[model samples]
Target: MIDVRAVNYTLQVAGRPLHILKNVSLQTKPSEVVAIVGPSGSGKTSLLMLLAGLERVTSGSLAVNGADLTALGEDDLARFRRHTMGIVFQSFHLIPSLSAIDNVGLALEIAAPELSQSQVREQASAALAAVGLAERLEHRPTALSGGEQQRVGLARAMVANPPLLLADEPTGNLDQKTGAMVIELMFNLARERGTAVVLITHDAALAARADRVLTMTQGELVEAAVTH
Candidate 1:
């Protein structure tokens, strides 16, 4: 579970402070999917970064799965992320030299250096298969389509089986149908894995699939009504 209270985020630019989030408080339960929908410059990415411990909160109380990220130093935050969280970015951050399977396997290997290469490969292969990318395991990002690359990214995220999954504009680069399928696959796997998902996206239809939809405006959060 995740909880936030009076979350305020600000960035200093040109020697002046610009508020990105204003007293935003939110709580998401385990296995619950929450979509953040907002206009550009509304702090969606800021919120995701705050939750992921990538960006420090200006003023707020926040906790994820009982860890107080605000109090953690860089090393502690890195450890927490390695053990309990995974992120998918709008740009697939795949290493150019590593194939899809190797990329995912490398994540597991980094997390557990003691694991044998064979074990790492097996786990990575399972992750790719779970995301329906078994055949593309040997392909590099440049050799794969956008959807294929993103699926490989999903496999990397899922390989850890972390409790919290944060996706930033996951479908931003794909076609409508491909985006839909990718989003659907993400939600299905998150639910099955009982992973709490905080998805930042601009698509209403994709937001509709979440257990809750939150609208952001001028850095404020307004929880929307979910309709069946």
Candidate 2:
């Protein structure tokens, strides 16, 4: 679940404030898939960052999974994200030096410190296997194809079973076929887990697949259409 009300985000550029998000309000329910389609610099990704607590809102309110993101301190925000949010980025954002399994396990180790090494490995293996990466668990990022690497990234994000998933151009770097596979995997996994998803993408057809489609322009959420 996510709730945002008239949220405004401003960034400092050359000592002057540049408005990024203006009067943005949105909500997502559990197991609901909402897609945000917008041009570059329209604040779609900024909104996702705000929802993830990676950036603080300049005004108004923002909450995800019942936590007031604007009110949390840095440490609390980090902890909240580790426990309640799963984010996938277009760039994959995998550590080059870490194996696929290690990368996924790191998330568990951070979020659930009480888990033993065997437990972490077991869970990470399962996550990777779910993404069709069981055979590549020990391979590093360089050893995998773009799709495989993205799958690994997906595995890492979902390893914690977070209630909310935020994806920013998740399929931007892959070929159409591979991107489709990744998107299907993402949606299916989210459905199975009842996770609320806020997806930021440029693909219209992809956006149309969501339960709702929202369009952003000039830092404002200008249109919202229910697709199903």
Candidate 3:
């Protein structure tokens, strides 16, 4: 679950303060998918970064799965990210040298350090299979197609079964057909696993598929009509 209250993010550009997010607030329950649709520079990605603890919130609070993200120290944020949240970026972010399985298992190996190598392998393999990438487990990112690489990224994000998933324009880099496939796979798998998802996307159709939709404009967030 996620609870963000009146969050504001400000940045220093040159000499004046630039407000990136203003009074943004939203809540999500287990297994729910919340999509954020916004124009460029509307603060959607910044909100996701804040949720992932990659950026600090200048005002208000962010609580994800019962952890007060604003109050967490640097080391604590890293540990929390490893164990409690999963993030999928616009870029796949897979290592060039690591195989798909290793890329997926790396997070698990860190979050569940007590698990044996075999156990980690087993979990990662299951996650890859769930994302329809079982046969590509041994392939590196460069060897796979765009969709396959994104599937590997999804597997990596889901392998640890974190409580919440944050995705920022996950399909932005792929073709329309490939992007649709990735979106469907992500939503179906997250729903099946009972994981809450916060998706940042510009595609209206994709945003419509979520349980709730929020629109961002000029750094403010407002509830958009749910189409379906």
Which residue pairs of candidate 2 clash? none
Model 3 scores a C-alpha lDDT of 0.92
TM-score (C-alpha, index-matched) for candidate 2: 0.97
By summed lDDT, the worst window of 10 consecutive residues in model 1 runs over: 106-115
lDDT of each residue in 114-145, candidate 3, tens digit only: 99999999999999999888898899999999
User: How far is 25's C-alpha from truth in model 2 (Å)?
Assistant: 0.2
Worst lDDT 10-window in candidate 3: 219-228
lDDT of 1 by residue, 1-228 (tens): 889999999889999999999999999899989999999999899998999999999998999999999999999999898888889988888999999989999888867788898999999999999889888889988999998888888888878889989999988999999999899999999988899999999999999999899999999999998745
Any idea what lDDT model 1 has? 0.91
Decide which is better by lDDT, 1 or 2. 2
Superior candidate under lDDT, 1 versus 3: 3
Cα deviation of 157 in candidate 1 (Å)? 0.7
**Residue ranges of candidate 2 with Cα displaced over 4 Å:** none
Global Cα RMSD, each model: 0.9, 1.0, 0.8
CA lDDT, every model vs. true structure = 0.91, 0.92, 0.92
Deviation from native of the Cα of residue 184 in model 2, angstroms: 0.3
